[model samples]
Target: MLLIVGAGFAGLSAALRARHLGVAVTVVAGRERAFDAPECLSLEGVRALHDCGLDARQLQLPPVREYISRWGESPMLSRAPPPGIPKNIMLGRVQLLRALRACATEEGVTFVEADELYRVLPTRQGLQLQFTGPVQELVLDASFAIDASGRAAVLARKLGVGRRTFDHLVAYGVRGPVHGLPEGVVHTFSVADGWVFAVSDSPGQAHVCFYTNGRLAGRVTEAKIMERVPYQIRSLMSDEDMWLASGVSAANASTSLLDVPGGTYWLACGDALQTVDPLSSSGITTALQQGAAAVSAAVASLSGNLEPMRAYWLESRAHFDSYVRNRNSFYGFGESAS
Candidate 1:
């Protein structure tokens, strides 16, 4: 049996693939914390979803048309399709999770909703996990474990995996009704020491956020950040007629990677393995694909072939290195924000 943790896109994709391969898989989900922001996916990412047996078309909504960014003194840059998005393709959290869970359930994947994981005991047969939900405590066994626990890397950390974080990037912002903006435009603006992003996830419901150093997050307020927003974005809420949800929130948007993707009978995928800047637009894209990657390595490891696990580590390292280079290159137009 295979045991998986977390229920985000990464976890669900892993479960969907594993069961399709006729593996007995059980998923332990502590919680699903959806980020209140817009998630972008490239064409390749859409293909990955279809590979995972999900109806990718259901999520294609709100329709993003172009990407606009104003950084340093460079002329405002605009990109279409590839960066703009090909068609009706904006991935929302609700639609994604609902579709993934439905697919997993129909395929005979067991789901255990738990409050927290208490113990991971190893036996000759497999790894035994003990967790508690609201009503009762439960235990399950599996030959291998796959961690999709997001940035926490819960299972990976417990198994002695170390993480190398590249920066102290954090994002603080709010989401609500934003009006009088070019419909379906994703905007990014470089401010005093950070950047601001604004986009309509659905109709008039806009998701906006400010990204900067963790230290500056606490010192800045929504009004102050809004003040730094470029005229184009500020125009969205600049009018007295415009209103929005108050109280900005914070979440880690740092770039980090795991020292080892996996060892022995366990491995990690998605945010648990590595994280990149949200602006890179690859986090969710890579996450949607990590499920299959994790399954391939885990299945090989379960069969006593450690080569796949080693290869997985090497691939993860290479991917992270390449991502950093690409991210840095993309930011070349802008001065350091933090």
Candidate 2:
């Protein structure tokens, strides 16, 4: 049996994939609520969901038709999907999580909710996990364990794996009702300090955020956020709209091949493995892809083949490096243009 931790896209995807392969899999989702900004599903992400038997349209996700981007003080530029490419979709983060949970349940994945992972013990055969909260004192064992715990890198940290964080990148944002943004369009505006991305998930409701250095984000006030955004977006902000703010380091990379793959009965996937820049808009896609790969690695490990795990680690690292290079190029272009 495989034990997958965390039930966001990565965990759910891994569970479903393992079950599809006839492996007994259980998911421990450590949180009850999924609180996040709206997510934009790239074309690859949409295809991945469909392959997993999930229909975003049936889930009532809003279609995103174009992107309007402005670098620094430059004029805004509009970009539509290229010919023959699939248009992206946008949906509230929590809504998407709920839909994914429902899909996983329908596919016979067992879910255990816990507030914390108290301990993890390595066994001769596999690993034992202890959970807290309603599952207090309960211990579960599995042939293989997967960590999909996002940027917290829950299992990785517990295993004493060092994390390399991109200190230069940080993001702060709020979600609330806003006006002036056209429905189905995502807007990104770069500023001297950082960049702002806003997308309307539903009529009159949008998630707006700023990506900047961690220090700058820490010092940024609500007033400063308003000033950084485009005038059209700034005009829409008002005291009446309740806004919630949160911040995090947006780019994190790990040498997973060196640090993760050689485990006898453990693997790490999704944001626990690496985090992408929001400007890349590939978080969900990366999570889903790695989740599926992790399952394959687990299955191969069960059969006494360690090559798959090594391969997956290498692939994940390469993907992360490529993303970092591209991110630097993108930010560099914005800087040079400014």
Error of 1 at 108 (Å): 1.0
**lDDT digits (tens) for residues 1-338 of candidate 2:** 69998998899889889878988889988766666677777889977787677887888766786777656453222232124433557777788778888888988999887777778889989989887867356688988999998877777677777766654455666667776776787887766666678887777877777666665555776556556654555655553335534232233222232255336688888888877766667889888888988999889979988888989888987887776665545444442212
Task: Summarize candidate 1's per-residue lDDT along 1-338 as a digit string, tens digits.
Answer: 89889888889999988987788888888765676456777777788888888767775576677766656442222222124434325677677777888989999999988877778777887777787877988787879999898898888777677998877888876776777656688777766666778777666767777787666655766566556555645566644224334666778999888888876667899999999987777777687788777887788777888787788778877887877775655555334322
For model 2, what is the error of residue 298's alpha carbon versus the real structure, in angstroms, after optimal superposition? 0.6
Q: What is the C-alpha local distance difference test score of candidate 2?
A: 0.72
**Which pairs clash in model 2?**
none
The local distance difference test score of each candidate is 0.74, 0.72
Measured with C-alpha atoms, the lDDT of residue 31 in candidate 2 is 64
lDDT at 256, model 1:
88
